[model samples]
Target: MDLSRPRCRLWRELVLVASLLACGIRQASSQIYITPDSLIGVERYSSSLAIENAPEDVQEYSWHRGANDTEENLIISYNATSHSRRDGPMYSGRESVSIRGTLRIWRSQLNDTGNYTVRVDTINDTQRATGWLEILELEIPQISVNTTSVVDGEDAVAATCYTNDSHVQWYVNHAPVSSNYRMTISPDNKTLIIRMFSRFDSPLQCGIEILPELIQKSDLVYVTVAYGPYSLQLRSSPTDFSGILSAEIGSQVEMECISYSRPESKYRWIHNGSLLSFSEKNITLPSLTWDQMGRYRCIAENSATQLTLYDEVHIQALWRRPVVSRSFTISGSLLVFLIIFTVLGFTHFLMVLIRALFRHYSTRANWSI
Candidate 1:
């Protein structure tokens, strides 16, 4: 054998050994970390902590209540071989560990706030990770109202927000509310008062900051505001009937009355100052006749506001000139037919008279001869 061949073989063996050592170093240097490094917990709620980059073939998992992984601080432990779990000295009834080395705390309370440590033991090695959780003294916010119904510009409405948090914010129609003559807020911003509640300030709400960037809102509170029978308007279906609608006789007409009111204004119709039989917002005239044409008025009233408003429309009857033109055409045709018949009858009479006279003369002549 040549000496150079042996040297090349020795160099190849050394390169293989270096590659194996690098892979072993990389595996040993891999770090284990915990998910949700920091979290906020609420009472009677659940929170979870999970491990990432943990060693595989984990045979045991141990969770501690504090950052230390001491035996006395162990909250819960799991045996991967038997797939069984045992409670430690610090184990609360709410703590559980998943097969993948995750810690879950149910019905978390204020005392649950602290650093948690998880130690995972695999067939080859062991690793540890820690995370912290904070518990907040918070609950769902609620709104209480003094009265649900109020008259516009005549009555006031008040609402109070109930929550454990003192920092509160008020909203109206989903928009932020501010202190003004019409509306006011309490010093703590918990109570909202409307001096003279209007329909615009409806659907009030309140909210509180539960966390640094999280806000919880209360349910909407609605106030029934009664106002206005104003802006009375009347329109016709054909749309041509307005202030002075000259409709042809026997044409159909539909009239609609509208107004701006909270409780929905009641409608009453009148024709030539006489109240119509129907009190509906809309009225239909199947056939427009002479008697139906006059000043039409719609009266809108609100029971809550005790206000009434009216809109009037003057409708004039048109003589349907097309029918008159048809009648004239028929009369002309009848006159022409009667004249032709009279001329034919006179000519027939003349012919009969001539024939009779001729027969009479012929007989006389014959006798005289």
Candidate 2:
């Protein structure tokens, strides 16, 4: 072997050894830290935590309630390097050496509320972290009205209240209503239902109160009571048909009569004091003959209230017969006679001319002879 070749191989081996040492040192120096070792909003609940840089084989992990390690609450003993799991009632992850595990607490119940801690152990060193869990029980109850408005005479309207806590009460118009018979509280005590048989036309108030804590009120809803009599009024196109007359017999006539009351109005046609059979919004007679000609009247009435209104129409019959007098007839006859006389006179003159011509012809012949 050549010396330079051996030297180069030795240098390469040294370089490789140095690189390995650097990587080993870096790995050894890298340590896991849990950010925010403590947390709130954990609200008496168990939460998850993230463990970072934990030894690849973390055999045992411990959890406790207090800062002193003496009182230990061993939650889990697992073998994993970088792992995450729910530690407390609240699901917040922890990665610092502080609290690397979740702490469980009952958020609604005030009992299981306190400081929580978690410790991670890797054969050589142990890391610890802590967090606190709080409890809140105040919650607003939900209130709802069945209907925004109720018709008059309608009764037993239901209003409902919902909440997280079981203790709930019902109220109407700011007064506490008994939750015994008319009002009912759900078994969970979270929902309160109230029913009232109300006749007042004014708006009624309803609300729900979570026992000793939260109260929610519903907006007022009105009830309408309707009572009225049907009334009729004749609404003619020309409200005043005072001077209208002599309408063509065959023309379409319109007479409008509308009921100004809740129910619709009924109408009947009357002509010359006789009640006609057909009735409608607009009365139309196809062809108004002489028999059907007379003073027409429209009677609009509300059957319920017996209220009636009348609209009269005067229709003049169309006289289509020829109206000529005796004098006119005689004059026409005389004119015809005069024309005949003139024609006869012209014929007679022509005949005379023919006869004269014939006589002249005969005389000329005699003279020639």
Candidate 3:
């Protein structure tokens, strides 16, 4: 649908009169013509219809609300000499005739829309003119928002008041609101512009005045407001410097990451480019070891606004207490002790060998002879 086009409709149509002259059908140009050949009337409003360009010495005029067959419904009649006017019984009070051969209808309704004709009688000739009237039916107005949901930083949003007529008003949470510096309304009072609005604002409505005693307001519509995720920060409870952490073996590790967003936000932690086992806002590693060292990224997402914030972190395990180094030094000491002991034993053996040889040679000469 094209929103810029006018919704109101006023239809006009030509209504030809039936043959009334005794001589047969006559040309339309020879008949008396109404000032406005066709017209449209609004419900409950008064409008007029008149005869014009009639020949001189016109004696009388009679008006009918339908085709020639419906002449009994003579709504109005005028006599030039007596300067008097009369109306039919059906139009006793709602319709009247003017002194100058015109018809006045008050409080027009939908049923009043139809073809009408007027017969003019003069001393020289008789003529007839035909016209039509279309009465418009009023309807209830409606209100619509361009979008049901919007981001906070949007430049503008439109709240439209939809109706056939130009008269309209707006409301917020049942309270009357008008165009201002922050809000603007179109010239036809059909569209309202809003510069900004938060989720805390109230619902909107559109209204119209059907009559002096009745005011019609449309159903309320609530809008949603979305914000962003900002200020992303991630850190461990024990503390680390620029994504570096020092934790001894068999020690528990705890880290907390957060970001700001409206309607809260969802958090995710990634370790070494993979999703961390922990689903909560915090990431924890049990008994920190060298294997835990890697890049840690915390992602914060705002679902409503579809915005995200991320921060990467690196952690390293710092060795505390040189227990293993001291144990390795003791093994080196044992090796040195074993080498010295082996050298001392070898020296003792050489000495024992020399002593044994000396004793055997000294005792062997007398015993063997």
Candidate 4:
């Protein structure tokens, strides 16, 4: 019985030495660390802060609101041994800690932006890890405008963006809107005003940055501007003619009028300074006569802008002439050759007949003698 007691004491000493060595190795090799040193949090959204490389002998996990692990800044603590959670003095109702020492915040607010610290308590040692979270407010922006339609160089328009986001940007036709003499933006970048609104300032939009890579844009706004009926152009179907159109009588001619204008320009045709009753953009003159030849006018008018412009083209009529072809000349030459050959052959045949008859009559007379 005395020998058994001594063996038991030696076994206990061996077990204690092994446990101490294990603890020393773990403390030296395994360093406690936190994932995502920096986190981006959105208002009214949920996110998490995770810790890695946790000590295997952890007894408790404490999450603090600030960079320090002091009792006053403690948020929530989880007891790894009992598998239970305890709320600290600084804990808000939205915060919770998981068994793996990860901190989760739901329905985050703007005040949640600050440093975060997590304390890991183990049987052998205590360690702390810190991180930073930046909270941003984001919302869908709405555009408000005084008027959606204006006259070029005659009216001014204003557009305002409504959103909870502090950072704002304005765009026109997908390009950034810069402040100039004709356009101005408010100091807060919420309102944009334009004096003498034109077509160049159309398709306006506003946007805000919700996160580092996420951007939210508002509905697009378009403005209608009445412009000019300038650059009057009159074109013909036979585009080869430059200033004047020379047409054969009974031929057809087509004329088209165009101008750069908003709401489309009304066109009229005039011939010899008289209205031709053509109100469309194009006109056709079929079977043109001598009277139709002269100066033709195309009048373009924009009622909204009260601007008028006209283009003119001269037309001359000429009698159609016949065209001789090589085939016709070749046929005439062949006919003349045939007539001359027939005449020569007939004359040769008559001379031979006369000679034969004279010879036969002489032989008959000699035989009779």
Q: Rate the local accuracy (lDDT) of all candidates.
A: 0.77, 0.47, 0.70, 0.78
The TM-score between candidate 1 and the true structure equals: 0.60
Ranked candidates (TM-score, high to low): 1, 4, 3, 2
lDDT of 4 by residue, 1-369 (tens): 011111111111111110000111122337775555666556666667778788788999999988899999989999999999989898889888888998888877889889999999999899988877766564778998899878788889999999866678888877887789988999888999989988888888999866433456899999999888878888985552676887877899888898999979988888998998889988888888988989998899888888899988888865467886656345777888888889899999998999999999999999999
Q: Candidate 2, overall lDDT?
A: 0.47
In model 2, the worst 10-residue window by lDDT is 14-23
lDDT tens digits, residue span 225-301, model 2:
22222244443322334624444556654555554432455678787889878678576656556676667676766
Residue-level lDDT tens digits of model 3 in 82-138: 787767644647676676677667767788888778888788788888777666564
* Regions of model 3 farther than 4 Å from truth: 1-142, 162-182, 195-202, 205-220, 239-245, 262-266, 273-279, 302-304, 318-369
- Tell me the TM-score of each prediction against the true structure: 0.60, 0.30, 0.39, 0.55
Q: Tell me the alpha-carbon RMSD of every candidate.
A: 16.2, 21.2, 19.4, 17.1
**Model 3 clashing residue pairs (backbone):** 243-314
Top candidate, metric lDDT: 4
- Candidates 1 and 2: which is better by lDDT? 1
- Model 4 clash pairs are none
Candidate 4 weakest ten by summed lDDT: 14-23
Order the candidates by lDDT, highest first — what do you get?
Answer: 4, 1, 3, 2
